[model samples]
Target chain A: MADGLRVGVVGATGQVGAVMRKLLAEREFPIAELRYFASARSAGSKLPWRDTEITIEDASTADPSGLDIALFSAGGSTSKAQAPRFAAAGVTVIDNSSAFRMDPDVPLVVSEVNPEAVKEARKGIIANPNCTTIAAMPVLKPLHDEAGLVRLVASTYQAVSGSGLAGVDELAGQVRAAAEHASLLTHDGAAIDFPKPEKYVRPIAFNVLPMAGSIVDDGEFETDEEKKFRNESRKILSIPGLAVSCTCVRVPVFSGHSVSVNAEFERPLSVERATELLTHAPGVELSEEPTPLQAAGNDPSYVGRIRVDPGVEGGRGLALFLSNDNLRKGAALNAIQIAELVAQQL
Target chain B: MADGLRVGVVGATGQVGAVMRKLLAEREFPIAELRYFASARSAGSKLPWRDTEITIEDASTADPSGLDIALFSAGGSTSKAQAPRFAAAGVTVIDNSSAFRMDPDVPLVVSEVNPEAVKEARKGIIANPNCTTIAAMPVLKPLHDEAGLVRLVASTYQAVSGSGLAGVDELAGQVRAAAEHASLLTHDGAAIDFPKPEKYVRPIAFNVLPMAGSIVDDGEFETDEEKKFRNESRKILSIPGLAVSCTCVRVPVFSGHSVSVNAEFERPLSVERATELLTHAPGVELSEEPTPLQAAGNDPSYVGRIRVDPGVEGGRGLALFLSNDNLRKGAALNAIQIAELVAQQL
Candidate 1:
């Protein structure tokens, strides 16, 4: 685990990839050489890595032999096509997409929660858990380890940035267009209005869409984001029998994704002691006022509203609110942590 | 109880007050005479009601001699002063503020769920249930009747309109500023920004805030909105033993308040039957795709995502999402419904 390492970030011009670059610079990841790759659309785009400008190369045509490590933030389609090639070239691939996450061979790792899982990465590429799963794992791991997580009911308010740079730009444009008293009555995806809703189906300026991702099949009328919540939680926490029901919402928020979680544990746990435990827990920042904006750009998951359900005696049931940076801890931070852990494990 | 009744609307020019006028007109309330009253700021404002323009009078100093019913949507301070005065003059006050909702004698009415409670209102001022309560009641009532509701664990994504026009302007302004790429990072509330955050603590543009009300005394770290949720649900549902723990959040959405609720019932109820019941439930509209925008300007509480929780299967638990116009069903609509019901009994 020496200081110098060659690192390459795929989808360099995308949202998570841009943050990966920023985090590398901010966290001072000991990079001897840095390479940037993107799709043909953003092929020659210049991405500022700290003060150094790195020109993006087309990922499909780019040679991966020079890079010691490659971070993938491109969509699942791109990651599926290119990751194995990079991995086969002996580059340790850390993916931030859903492509190989649920593959039995790939180990889904969250550094602070499951650093040990990285050791089981037999397929060369280590999978990063979904943003929602990434956010909750830090907070849940400690509690789940202590009392054994029985059931989890989570309702997520996911920020637009989780979608991509397009998400941020779309929301920004909506905010601008909604400023002038535009008639919302005649302006829902119709005419005579704002940025024309390029990102979302509806005007996100003043609305929230409950359905996030296509309602892909796992049955129970669940969206792909909701399925990710269940599948990822099972993999990360190793709670295969865990009863989880999630309603993932796309809010007008920009960065961090916030979840209100009701967790029923096997044994009793007190709120007072949980607060004391979280104060000492790693990667879990305890906040009296936890909001999406406060958790934005931060690495730690901000947890608050620690209380026991009076319906359950001996504090077996607890409710909490947690917010995590969808870009950082939710994607780039976890990937960086995994890289750091890989530097240790390998 | 007749087909026509004299009705006076207090704080007519204000936010919820304007919606009260809209709902009343849209529903075709049998109004023999309609009077509009507002603060000194809106004393000369003209309001349209059922194809007639009503002249607004100063509510604080107005004579309340002959009105049959008075709906108050003004602030708590205004309600504290004017409600009793109007009530003393024999004009039944359907108050919309939290000033008197908890009072035992006052009937907190959500007409679809608790109309019978209104007949027992000895207090002239009948309290309108909290907006959150109003949105959740229709679905909970039928289910609670069939199987006793044991606990409700909820997280709310409330709309800005629930606060008032100032909130709408706050959200709109923050979006505008964020769009123009104005400074939000260093915004200390200096006067230059167009969407300068005036109503909330942080910029609402592309953000979700957990802090809705001032951190009041909740024994522990529970927010005022959280406490309101717990206490208000108890009063509205008439189930004191219903354990409720809620995290109230302000989303990027503009109009409707959406809630993710997990309720445990005494008898084992299936999601199939629950869906069938909620499909025909009063004031509740079951939607496969419910968004904050669609619920805006509509009165029905939208419900979906009905799934069975195996953890509480012995007690029959269902996870559902509820979205309703916070201004209408939550504030103005509920108040007007109470007025409509009270008009029948008068």
Candidate 2:
């Protein structure tokens, strides 16, 4: 395990997979040998790394031996079928899928918030929090520590890339179509002919979709993305009693996700105190006004617009807004950062 | 005032004011004489209504006599200066700006929620609620009627049209720029040359700005839009002590404004009951998955994604999302509806 670290990137041809490779190079992660894996369709394709081409192997039937660590960005079903195999082969798998995030034996880790929880991964598979939840962790960690956060109400303005490359292509195609017609912006919903939407339930060009992920059929009537916000926040924050209500809305942005968070804490906290604490918090940059475009290439959660919530009694609640790059800090970079933390243990 | 009614549209060339004229014509409101008013720049412009061309008069210096109702959508300063003069002339002024919304003498009306409050316009002036607040009223009215709503937490995805024509041009210009260089979508944030943003503080193309209105500088650190949500909701809902917290965000959509509302009531309400109530709620239409595009040219607030907030006790709270056209229902339609209600009294 000592010739630097043998690393494998599952789903190497996908959007977040591409970001994972870029972050691995940009962050200078210690890598001796790098392997790429994709589905059968992209198996024989080559992806550039440093000046060379690495051929992607089919992840469905690949040898997982001799790899010190594997970062899985494949879909949930693929990870459910393959992550255990890699973990069994003595490869520590850090998965970005939602498959094992709530598993008792698999620890969901945000590198900056709960790095200590990494040691509790008895399944040898550390789960990455959902991209939306990941972007919120660093911002909430400091506030939760100070006031003992009890509840969170969040409304998300998520990027299309959070859906996948297909989502990106859908938005881009529609934007081009709408640009050509120009009537799409001026008239009613059906005035302009958009390409039939195959990826999302509605048109993604110049619109805001309230439901992000497909609605889970359970009686709760919450989307998988909304449920993930609840379950993942409870698990990562280690607050069994923390109450979370979230509305996940997808906007037309390409790379960044922004959240409007109203957090209620047990102890009293003021806007000035919350802003002061956030100024020094790790992985958070306080700004006067934070937007997704500014956060697209940045790493920290750009937080601002802090105010007191009159809804929460006696100033125990604070409302703030934050934007973070969904592909970077939300998915790939966090997984790579967790792997780097794992390397220290090795 | 005998044969139909005389109507004047102040700021006739503006976005919401244009919609006001269109709606007045579409709804076939009883209009015997129609007049247009604007600043010195647009004073002489000719606007058509049916078969006649109406010349725009300078609102500041124009005699307000003989008008039955004046719908003012101009900026706050113009409204503040002109509304009282119209009121003194015995003309009912329905202002769309924030100028008279908080004035106790001027009743802030949402048509569906507080139609009875319209008769309390002591200053002979009625105020239209903020666009974001107007979007939520129809959706909230029924639920609040069934179960006494005690608290509200709202996060808004407001459109650029809420800012006026400059905002529309800025987003259009930036999208064209980003489209010309496709590398902007593929690469980082700096890869694109966006037009220098003149309307907003940040780039609104392919991005979300968390701060919609500039901070009011009242030491509360809230944007004027956020404050409007609180003040106007209390006035319209007749809930003086009802708690409210809101975060207003600007999205790239052209016309629709969507709100994610988590409302806590004193009485228990299930998703079934809430959906049933909303199905019959005036000015609200229940849909499966409501998006901004579908609501852009529509009159109703398209409400969907209703679910139970586990965060609230005993199913006393419900979380839902709604989209309504900012220019149509949010501003112009509501003002027109108030005028019709006032027409009955006339």
The models' CA-based lDDT, in order, is: 0.81, 0.90
For residues A1-346, write the lDDT of model 2, one tens digit per residue: 4668999999999888999999999998999999999999999889999999999999989898999999999999999999999999999999999999999999999998999999998999999999999999999999999999999999999999898888888888887777766556552443657889999978887899998998898887788999899899999999988899999989988888889999999999999888889989989999888887788878999999888988888789989999899999999999999999999999
Q: DockQ of candidates 1 onward, in order? A: 0.44, 0.67
Q: Give the clash total for candidate 1.
A: 3
Against the true structure, whose DockQ is highest?
2
> What's the lDDT for residue A198 in model 2?
90
User: What is the alpha-carbon lDDT for the whole of candidate 1?
Assistant: 0.81
lDDT of 1 by residue, B232-303 (tens): 778888898788878788876667888888899989888888988898898989988676777876779988
lDDT of 1 by residue, A68-116 (tens): 7899999899999999999999999999889999999899998888788
lDDT of 2 by residue, B30-119 (tens): 998889999999998899888788899999999999999999999999999999999999999999999889888889998888898889
- Candidate 1 chain B: worst-modelled 10 consecutive residues by lDDT: B185-194
In model 1 chain A, where is the ten-residue run with the lowest total lDDT?
Answer: A184-193
